[model samples]
Target: MTAIELTGVTKRFGDVVALRDLDLAVEDGEVFGFLGPNGAGKSTTINLLLDFARPTEGRAEVLGMDAQRRSQEVRRRTGVLPEGFRTYDRLTGRQHVEFAIDSKEANNDPMDVLERVGIAEAADRKVGGYSKGMTQRLALGMAITGEPELLILDEPSTGLDPNGAREMRELVREERDRGATIFFSSHILEQVEAVCDRIGILRGGELVAEDSVSGLREAAGTAQTLEVTVSRADEELVASVRTVEGVSNVTASGDRLSVACDPDAKTRVLERIESEGVTVEDFSTEEASLEELFVSYTTDEQAASEQRGRTSDGKNSEGEDDERTESESESEEVRA
Candidate 1:
């Protein structure tokens, strides 16, 4: 079942287009990570999904219902830890959870939710004095009040320490195990990579890449670096390894040959080394990290735009300088 679907959805704020021709589908019972740099329209897409804003074109559906038409029903079944959520300063943390429970008409012990978020000790304390991390925990506690089937968490680990972030990921896993579909968004690639089943990357108001974690790594053309340690680095052996199919590049160190190749070629390369009568002392393979893959995709467009800007400035620099000189002369004449 599709938990959330957006088809040809476009949102604009007067002259500024926030999202354009966006299409996405999140399946049931999977944790989907929405990732992008700031101002990439992640929030706008979420707003459309929650019916907080109407799309200028196309439609958004949450839990198989039109988001705008069934906004109330959607809220009832969805728990949101919204980005930049503000809590009542005077209210106690326990009161916040209780309020959510009451609003959802859910029978839940507020303390349990508080404990789950690791804020039980501070539950009865007034929120006015809570730290930012504690306040984030309080908001999370409220989000889980009714065991909602769908959870939309935007930057859920904000202000959390390492331990707290780990705990949050654990809770995400727990919720997913309980059959909840979680749509999580964050700029922190490590956290998202840790918890997400599939990830979608948005760039310039469009869905740029969507796939499983490994699938994305593959799409990014990330290769595995294989280092084969031999008793002696042989030039002939290295040349043979380079000729193997899927092997992109090869370099030799003192006693190690580092080969960059497709992951599937690792075995073939290793087999060929033994075939060449070289004794393999040790070998190690390092695959591309998610962080590297993320930067490659997200920064490419930005880098291109910057290059274009530089080219335009270079072309007009002489003209701009001449205009500046003419303006200064005109100003001096007026003064005279």
Candidate 2:
């Protein structure tokens, strides 16, 4: 079943359009990555799902209900970590999570949630004293108060240290394993590349690409990085492998060779190496990274967004102001 679905969703703020004829779907029980540069309608799409704002045209559905019409019910089953949420400063971490549990009408032990987010020791500390990473963890703990079916996380790794970011990625996987659908958004391409089963990239308020990482590499005709551990690596082997069609670059070290080539050229690469009297002990092909694929698709649009940002009105071409205040209003809805 699809946990989230949007069809022909166009959101406009007066003369500026934040989204245009967008269509997206995230399957149940999968970690789906939502990617876009600043002002790419990423937040607009999130707002539409939670019914914080209505689409100017078309429809949005979450958990099988009309997002705009059944908003409260939808919010009840969904957990959100918005980009700029303001947590209560005077409250302790535990207090924050307990309040979320109460608001969600859930019977959860606050400490368990805190522990899951790696902030249990600081559970009693006032949020005002917490570091940015710790505060982010606290918000995440609160969002998981009810074991929500859908998790909408916007830049979840913000302020998290390397270790904290890694832990958050693991938590996302755990939640997905427990039957939750995660709509993860982050500028950290590695994090998205690691956790996402599939990705949808938004550009100029439209989804420019949506597919698995491998699918995207194929669609873009990007090269794969092939690492071959050979019994011997020599210039002869390197030069011979380079002669193979589609083999772009070859680098050799002690007993290993790194070859960048087209996916179909992999077999010929190996054959060339073996024919050159080198034993291919082991080999692996790594798909192009999500970052490379992302840049390939959105570089032009990003440049365009920058040019539009210079407009006298100060709104991003993608309508970053696209009613940014709506995000603040939606924060209240999420907290409620």
Candidate 3:
């Protein structure tokens, strides 16, 4: 069974619709990254899963239980490390974990939990004196109190240094290895790309895309970078490559030229550079980064939606003439 599933889920706040008819699912035992910009209803979806808010239409299920009807049960089996997690200033790290353990009626030792999150030495230190990164680790410690079947992490790497961030990734894997499903949501694109097995991107309060990083990159149709090693690199050569029909970015460093262009244009790019008395030594292609894929999917989806809206609004008289001109220009560009 899927660890989490939402079917036709729609949420609204008064007159404002927060989520459309959304259908999403996270398979059991996989780390699923939830991504979106602000005001994208990511928090709203979390609230619905935890029953902090009710969906205006459709169903939400967590661990095979109704999110609204059996919320208590669902939460009991799920562990959450919320965004900007708070702690009592006067309490020690041990005390915080103890509280969480008691609240969950868990048998986990507070010190063991603290140790797992790399805060055992600071177990007795007042949280008021902790660094932001340490505090994040402590909160993550609390979330693992009962070895929950599902883990939901919201910006789990916030305030952590590179080392702590690395540790967080390890711990996430450890939990998954021990049979837990992780729902990781964060704006840290690289971290998400490194850790998540699959991801679902939310845009404008709807799920715009979902897949593994490579899969999404393919679906988004973003350009790949061709790093070509050449005998010589110069300004004239860079400028020549820039005018390639599908080329978007061209840069030179030492004897290498990094060209961002459509897959079909790679041969043309190399030929253009070679034509300029430059010997092509060696070259390699790199996939687009997660960050680039994010922008493309989000912006492209919005652009497509806007175009459909304009078309549906109708074009007549003078407007039709202008539309024809625009279409002709676009077609000519495509043909070129």
Candidate 4:
């Protein structure tokens, strides 16, 4: 069953469009990541899902309930850790969790949730003295204290260290394993790559791409990083290597050549280097990661959006033309 659904959701503020016909769905017990550049309306969409703001058009649903009409009920069953949310400065970490329990009318043990979030040791310290990472942990603990069926985390790992980030990812997985759906929003590609089962990338208030990490990488045609250390440094040989098809952005530092190339083309590169009589000392290829793929898509999407805006003469282009054509055909009468 789908836990969250947005159908053609649109929002505007005066002359600026925040979201334009955004459509998305997240299945139950799945970790869905919402990725986007700044000003792409990622937060706006989250606010709509949480019913903090009503959409100008379209509809949003959470847990099979209309988001705007049933906001109170939705809040009762969902946990939210919004970006830049501030906790009570005088309240200790434990107090924050306890407050959440009270606010949610849940009978959860505050200490247990604190310990689970690795903030038990800091439970007694006032939130004003807590570091950024500690505060994030406290927020997560509060969000999870009620064990809600769905969790919405916005930039949840922003202040975490490497270890803390890893723990956060594990916590998200654990929550999903326990039958909770997670909608995680972040600009950090690595975090999304590590935890998300599926991803939706927003650009200029539009969902430009939606797929699994691997699927996005495949769609972007990202290349692997191939590093090779050779015994002899030959300028001609390096030039030849650069000419090899599917190789991109080749850099040679002394005898080591770092080549970004399609992973499938590595064998051909190896054979060409071997035929050139260069003694290869060491070689390895790391697969194209989700980070690279995200960069490619976000960058391309931004560029494309800009191009469209620059070229548009305030009229519908091919996309709008196709839509108009389809609508006309759909509305036409059919003869027997």
Q: Which regions of candidate 4 deviate over 4 angstroms?
A: 220-288, 300-336
Assess each prediction's global lDDT (C-alpha) against the native. 0.84, 0.82, 0.83, 0.81
Residue range 201-260, candidate 3, lDDT tens digits: 898778988999778767545578889999988876775565555666667999999877
Total colliding residue pairs, candidate 4: 0
> Which residue pairs clash within candidate 2?
319-322
Q: List clash counts for every candidate, in order.
A: 0, 1, 0, 0
Model 4, 1-336: lDDT tens digits are 889999999999889999999899999988999998877898999899888889999999999999999998998999998887887899888889988999999999999999988989988889999999999999999888788999999999979999999999999999998999999999988788889989999888988889987788776555787889988656556655644556554557899877667877787677667867788889988775666556655664333333333333323324344434443344342211
Between the candidate structures 1 and 2, which one is better when assessed by TM-score? Answer: 1
**Per-residue lDDT over 1-336 for candidate 1, one digit per residue giving the tens place of the 0 to 100 score:** 899999999998999999999999999999999999888899889999898899999999999999999998999999999898788999999999999999999999999999999999998899998998999988888888899999999999998999999999999999999999999998778888999999999887889889998798776456777888987676666656655666656668898998877888898888777867788899998875577567655765333333323322222224244543444455456557
In order of TM-score, best first, we have 3, 1, 4, 2
Rank by lDDT (best first): 1, 3, 2, 4
TM-score of each: 0.74, 0.71, 0.74, 0.73
lDDT of 2 by residue, 192-269 (tens): 888999989988899998999668756645677789999989766665565566665667999989887789989888
Kindly indicate the candidate among 1 and 4 with the higher lDDT.
1
